[model samples]
Target chain A: MIGDKIQEMFLENQENFLIPAREVAHVQAENNLNHALLVLTKIGFNVIVVLDKEARVSGLISIPLIIEAITGVTEIHFDRLDSLTVGEVMRTDFAVLNDDYELEDLLHLLVDNAFICIVDNEKKFQGIVTRREILKSVNHVAHEFEHRYDVQLHQESIFQ
Target chain B: MIGDKIQEMFLENQENFLIPAREVAHVQAENNLNHALLVLTKIGFNVIVVLDKEARVSGLISIPLIIEAITGVTEIHFDRLDSLTVGEVMRTDFAVLNDDYELEDLLHLLVDNAFICIVDNEKKFQGIVTRREILKSVNHVAHEFEHRYDVQLHQESIFQ
Candidate 1:
């Protein structure tokens, strides 16, 4: 029964695992980097996805990029920090997963990324899957196992 | 009692909270970017600390950095990937926490950083405290409260 429960939680359909994009932190490519960083900080996300003019996936900006800008490591002119847009500072290299992606494949992407960006068939920006969310799901399933294990032990003791 | 537990976990002495440097993924400054990325992938870390010639903390190379390097967005020459070293692309701007740092201060840092580097006053690399580890600790404490609440509810129902 515990094995079945594990299968139900872990091996379930992909639709149940999709974290809605509304729960993720994202910024438009046209937005100022300064404003994006401010909003990103408030959201407490390690990385913020950048969406294009049509709300499609574009790139990502993270705390490290902010630090680089602050340290003058990047070519961003200090005086233009107020005007620099997300498109100029965000790294365009990122993996975009479709709605049909398997949880197993998503786990592989999470191994190298802080979060995975999901998009629809039309390239509409959707929600992201974060390691924290996945871990939270795991902890919930673990509690179920713990509860069932206690009941099993109780029944065994009564029979003895 | 929950407040006391929070205090015990969050306000306790710093020594108990150290995650140990050996547990972190690190690369030498002179190591090639190709090799560094390979090790980083194998270790499944979002970021890898770059150590200098004297084995002292130098900078950090994260997944985003690797992504940038691959995309040729950074100043690093794409043709020199094999010859390029971690030192060429690592971010020198990083916050280092000493052993005496308060958990509150560490939490503040972790709000934006995936992990905070810990070092001795001599600047010797210690370990890193990841957000994942802190969340896991919090979850453990939360379960205790949940168990107590459940038992209380059970007893009240029996009395009724």
Candidate 2:
């Protein structure tokens, strides 16, 4: 069926889907909120991985978390950024995948997340699988299928 | 064969994928950065819609944009939040889909974006199609296909 074909496609292209850890912007857990904020703004990604001194995945931090940490009852305490650490406010309750994850596994987790952190058996950060990659794979499969079946499944133009 | 079935599934479940505009958080273009930040923090989304007086989508403002706006060469000028308007800092070059967008159109656009804004003929904001919903739809289709084919395509548990 189509599911099997999709699975096959994923298996064939899984290696290219991962954005290597080196390519992803990340911060150490001990880093201050100000530094973390700089990294986030410079990279233009809302969330980034937090790493430990041993190069293991610690957690994830985002702009929202920083905002929440510095917000007070009626005002934002911008001064708090100077005193807080990334580890103090970072979210630890996120999902991660080991090296042996399948395409279905990636698809299942991405239903609720924009990206999935990949880790090794030692809990060290490996890389990330983003929804963009999965969507591209799906698109590629659809196009290939259309060609093979000799049918036009969608309009030629993209959504305006 | 499999691609045809997948296309049919997408067509069948397209209606349930959109998150209505009313349910989405938004701010008027005239709103100050402080108000926009408050809305973003309260809603827990990094980005939100910017609407004009006529309720048409003027642009989008994100936390990163706000950060870029307030940060100077040496320090972050938090006071600028009171002076800046959402319209001045918002990104206006994003892609938008009309009301007539199809499932494939959405999939194609979402390959590069986390979400696509849905607008009307007058360019008024209608709603949003998010990657989360698309992933859910894809998962549902895969499970259905597995059942109909009497095959186990994936392991029982999701990615750990």
Candidate 3:
């Protein structure tokens, strides 16, 4: 994901941020710009994968919603930052790195899932890796598990 | 942010991701890992700042809330991405950039708040730039406007 790194950008470009299902780019939580440019040129858009019903990655849709739906409306409210989408424009209180953690705990999930979240233990999504792919898998496992490891991978202890 | 470009070891050094509201790290919405590691070692924390109810910038709690609170448990229906927060975890669908647009539309807002807003229009914060800070401010304003051309900024909008 921009010259992979950060555990192969969350384990090999984590499905390029999943955009299939007929190239999604919705516009119905309200606000529409020619159907968000017809779902951004038929799904070649920047971001907008939200599904909603409580969650389904529940947030995304930024490409400035086609320049604030053709600019200057004066709506201003629902907590600014340019008329929030893709289901309240996600960032969903960030963080989510469980590909089975390692890579110095995926470099401490590099914060703000602006990239990284390849979960599977039912956390779902099973894809996403950026912060430039766990800082390129912590320089590829720092050659011999960097300084006697600090992670110790969740210290298991569940096997009884 | 990936050693500011995947540890080429600091791409000629000058990295920037400034933060100081006491080094952030302040979780609450009931996930409490010893009070989030004592608020991430008293604010020297790398990330984890999810605030809402008008506290401003929400979402972001790195290391995936200590790996889903040390391997999920609080009632097995789990995977609320580890009990969300900061107003049910951030990324409230964003796209707010009125720092007077047209810097290639703020360098394509580095494709979605580069990992959650950095804000400016009286929202304050001010220090949060990416797309690698708009490619290092387009090479420091093209080497200080190459001997100056009524310097303020602009080079054919860098390409619409």
What CAPRI grade goes to candidate 1? incorrect
Clash count for each candidate, listed in order shown: 2, 1, 27
Model 3: per-residue Cα lDDT over A123-147, one tens digit each: 5544455554333332333331222
TM-score of chain A of 3: 0.27
Better by TM-score, candidate 3 or 2: 2
Clashing pairs in 1: A21-A127, B21-B127
- Candidate 1, after superposition: displacement of residue A40 in Å? 18
Question: Highest DockQ, which number?
Answer: 2
Ten-residue segment with the worst summed lDDT in candidate 1 chain A? A145-154
Model 2 ranges with Cα > 4 A deviation: A149-160, B1-4, B146-160
CAPRI-style class, candidate 2? acceptable
Per-residue C-alpha lDDT of model 1 across residues A53-98, encoded as one tens digit per residue? 7888889987456545534332323345466777877889897789
- The candidate, 1 or 3, that scores higher on DockQ is 1
Predicted candidate 2 versus true structure: per-residue lDDT over B61-139, tens digit per residue: 9999999999988688999999999989999987689989866787888998788999999988888888888888777
Candidate 1 per-residue lDDT, tens place, B1-160, comes to 1123233533333344567877777898889776675665456455788987665789998645754554432232335557777888899998778866765566656645777888888888888877666655444433332332221123334466
Provide the lDDT at B51 for model 3.
52
